[model samples]
Target chain A: MSYKLQFAELLPYWNVLLQGLIFTIVLTVVSTVAGIAVGTAGASARTFGPVWLGRIVAVYVELIRNTPFIVQLFFIFFGLPALGLKLSETTAAFLAMVINLGAYSTEIIRAGIEAVPKGHIEAGLSLAMTKWEVLRRIVLNQAFRKIYPALSSQIIIVMLGSAVVSQISAEDLTYAANFVASRNFRNFEVYLLAALAYLVLAMLTRSLLRALGRVIFKAR
Target chain B: MLQFSFWDILSNLLIATQWTIVLSLIAFVCGGIVGLALLFMRTSRIPALEWFTKVYIEFFQGTPLLMQLFLFFFGIALFGFEVSPWTAATLALTFWTSAFLTEVWRGCVESIPKGQWEASSSLALSYIEQMRYVILPQASRIAVAPTVGFSVQVIKGTALASIIGFVELTKAGTMLNNATFRPFLVYSLVALIYFCLCFPLSWWAKKIEGRLNVAR
Candidate 1:
């Protein structure tokens, strides 16, 4: 069967594609911010909180890390409604991405925190610096510097994972791709374009994170 | 109200869990085979072959698996080949798995000291002999834990197969939710089963790494 490739068919839907890309980026940015907050808090809880709290954080980390992100998204999107806690598709997707990234980053940040020398904390104590001040001024920044690479990779993984949110009609990049494909019956071309878009997004995200890292960490 | 008894939901989910396991296994085995070959090509000194394999890994790793599954599901059918959900999931996942495993194995192989390769070469070992007798033996020790850890990822990945209509755990949960309207129970049960399947593997991988670290 001779088939001609038709990239022209999708030309009209370029705005939808652009909107989808924006939503995808919006989700990633929101989730990255929320996830880092959740992760830093969880990491500190696991590292320096009371034993019981640490154990609870441990369980949360394991549960999130072990299961699939898509399952977690489904649970939030579908399951929560049953519990009378209704969330929009976009909200559910954002919550799931943050939760997923938070769990993984907890571990990453924990590793970085552990790598901080015990003497550093003792020195802060000897200087009469409150524990919170030490953590804020010294430990947290150093931990962020140390684990920035792993943390960025996890963020990218979550970005790629945002594609699954399309399954629930979240109107992300993949959702728009699906919309255009179903409309034009150009499944192959549409998906091929979607794949390329994701590839470019991944590369762009990596470089952006790397540059961001340089600015934030202020190191070579 | 369509009454799906608690037992009814449990049994249906238990059955669907089997497909999840099956798809993960297929992807793991097939991806391992393909990944090993890719690893060799990437590690080889041939510039063209190395470049080709590097590009292959990046393409597969950089793109999302959901897109790959969609392409295989509909792309093959466009060429007049009837693509079952099972076949499409497995094919895309295998490629996805190979890309990651190749990179993982390369890290292990490269972790071997530079002097080891020089010493083996000076001792008149051929490239193949050196790999078999020297490099592989050392690298396999490092590779085993990560490879098993990666199985959890492979299992979780099979969940996406449901998007294309593969009746895995996630798919089963969605279907049962539709039928029973007990989304909370169905999905909670589904997530629990995944945790059960994946947690032990992750725990084992960590345990192995702990032991290896102590040994090192």
Candidate 2:
């Protein structure tokens, strides 16, 4: 099957594509930070909180982890207004993302938290550190470093997952792809190009995360 | 002013749940076949074949399933071939699902000790024989938890097909919400249906993972 490549015709859409990319990157960064914060809290709850708290964490993690993210997105984008809380489309999309990311991040962080050596916590305690200080300075620091690579991979996954936001018309890269495909009548070529763009974006994200890791955990 | 009614929406919402299950099952089964082929290709000694498989996985993994659906459902039609949204949805998801499942299964396959592969080969077992009698049986155990876990991804992924007019759970919910004008109450039911379908699988996957870790 002979297929024509139309890379040149796509040049005019570069600005739009660039805008979409910027939007995606920003959403990813915001969600990643929020996800980490929520995930860290969830993980800590599961690891050290009381039995009831752990059970609540388990329910949240399991529900989010099992379901398709798009389903979760739709639930938030479409479901919540029935409860008398109405958010704008982009707000719904962004909030859905944070919730979804938070769940997956929770499990990943929990694993890291669990892997923290007990002896290290004891050593910190011996140094007269308060319990909270020991956990923050010793346990969490080691856990974050250990899970840096896993967390980086998860962030990329979240970045890619952000494409679902297009359903709510948030104008991200996938939404832009839909626009280009619709206008240019080059569905295959447009999507193929979009796929390539996503690949480049993921590679860039992975590298950026690694750079962030290097600065944050200079000991590595 | 989308006034929400509880039981009115709940009744129809229950039916949408079935479509989600159907789509997930279809995608998972189709992906397994494609995944197995890709796994075999990865293990092949041919460098080009291996590179092709790698590229295939990376492409699917890197892109969101949403774009792939648009490309397949709309892209094919642009080339003068009419594709049903259902077909496009299935094809795109099957392709995407294969990538992740193959990578997951391949890891399980390769993680089997090298000595076992060598032992089977030294015993004059052909490649297929070695895989069937020695390698695969053990790898099957490792593959189970991850493969089951990956199915949740497939189930989740089917939701993307709703954009192309496939009336799965999310699509149904979208339409219902438009008509009923009660997005929140309608969608919470949708989310609950999805949670019902996915949670058990997630639990089973974790149960297996814990056991696998213990075995290791």
Candidate 3:
């Protein structure tokens, strides 16, 4: 009971922690963009592509969604090197995040696409719009609007899940915390600080995504 | 050099899988009880209790489950308790699971019309009586599908426990990979085993959800 919290012990390592935080943010941003692009393409393929293509996407989604992200990270980081496809820890981590988020967002976006009324697409088609134009102008805008909130939540989940990338020495925020904790032997304080940082990051990411949504949708 | 046959690896992993299942069940059951308590506090119409529950949920939901595990793993040692990874994993996953389940169940409870509550109260039923007799029954029917769905999350969350040196399936996979030096084969098997454990639950949840939607 006499153990006093020594958060100040971690102060000297603030630069390291800050670097990790920025790296994590970079990871989140890059993964969010790439992941959503992949998801959109996957969703479109599932909804509009050939039967074989749709089945391929379905299998990919199911395989990723059912397994844990950490396992996926391990598979990419460790398993792939055996196949002569070696990647840096950071690249592997980023790939895992993108693939993980892509699967979840694919499902979310697919639901939104399916929710778009058939009548609306037909209306767009009758307006002299080609299939691609109708899908781009009419289908996706509304679908993204419907699923933006869920998509935002999944993005944040991926951001938080990025903590595990440290297990492979990716040197993200959690890795920084572990480094500091090891140096100072203040495991409790360092982890407490890191957890609070993550809480703040999650909140900030949530609001930022909300603001982005408002700008994109422009519908209240 | 010790050679581990494929069966040797598979048999060891299957054993470790039991701990993963056990840990998940403990987290789900304990978290359910705690989450139900939080659900009541959140909906109890008391401002302070409601606010406290809100902060509790926000803290757990906002942070990573891995951070929570580290906190529990190292945080307990500060209290002079010789904490095993099992206890830390259980405590951390329980709190994490409770936060999510409370949110899920809160939606279910709130979806019940206010008229149900008013009607129960008008019949001279107490708050607990109303919840027990009327609200929970209705809410639980809607809650079942999502609750089952969330169990997959609980199971996956246990994978992080491996990082803290818990001898669960993921940890065993890592150990076996080191022993066998076949990361591709080992991790693939690990992921496949998890998929086998989880996919059925995910499918069942979707099926139940579909049935509920049809019933509605």
For each candidate, the alpha-carbon lDDT, in order, equals: 0.93, 0.84, 0.95
Residue B204 of model 1, lDDT score: 99
**Candidates' DockQ values?**
0.86, 0.56, 0.90
Question: What's the TM-score of every candidate structure?
Answer: 0.98, 0.93, 0.99
Model 3: which docking level applies?
high
Question: How good is the docking of model 2, as DockQ?
Answer: 0.56
Residues B1-216 of candidate 2: C-alpha lDDT, one tens digit per residue: 655467757767778777778877888899899998888889977899899999889888888777788778866776677799889998998899889999898998999999998999999998878888998899998999999888877878887788889988888888888888766666777778777877888789989999999987
Give one clash count per candidate, in the order shown: 0, 8, 0
Off by over 4 Å in 1: none
User: Evaluated with TM-score, which candidate comes out highest?
Assistant: 3
Better of 1 and 3 by lDDT: 3
Instruction: For candidate 1, write residues B1-216 as lDDT tens digits.
Output: 657899999999999999999999999999999999998889889999899998998889888999999989988897888999999999999999999999999999999999989999999998888888999999999999999999999999999999999999999999999998888998899999999999999999999999999998
Give residue A193's lDDT in candidate 1 (0 to 100): 90
lDDT of 3 by residue, B35-131 (tens): 9999999989999999999999999999999999999999999989999999999999999999999999999999999999999999999888899
Candidate 3 total steric clashes: 0
Q: Give model 1's docking category.
A: high
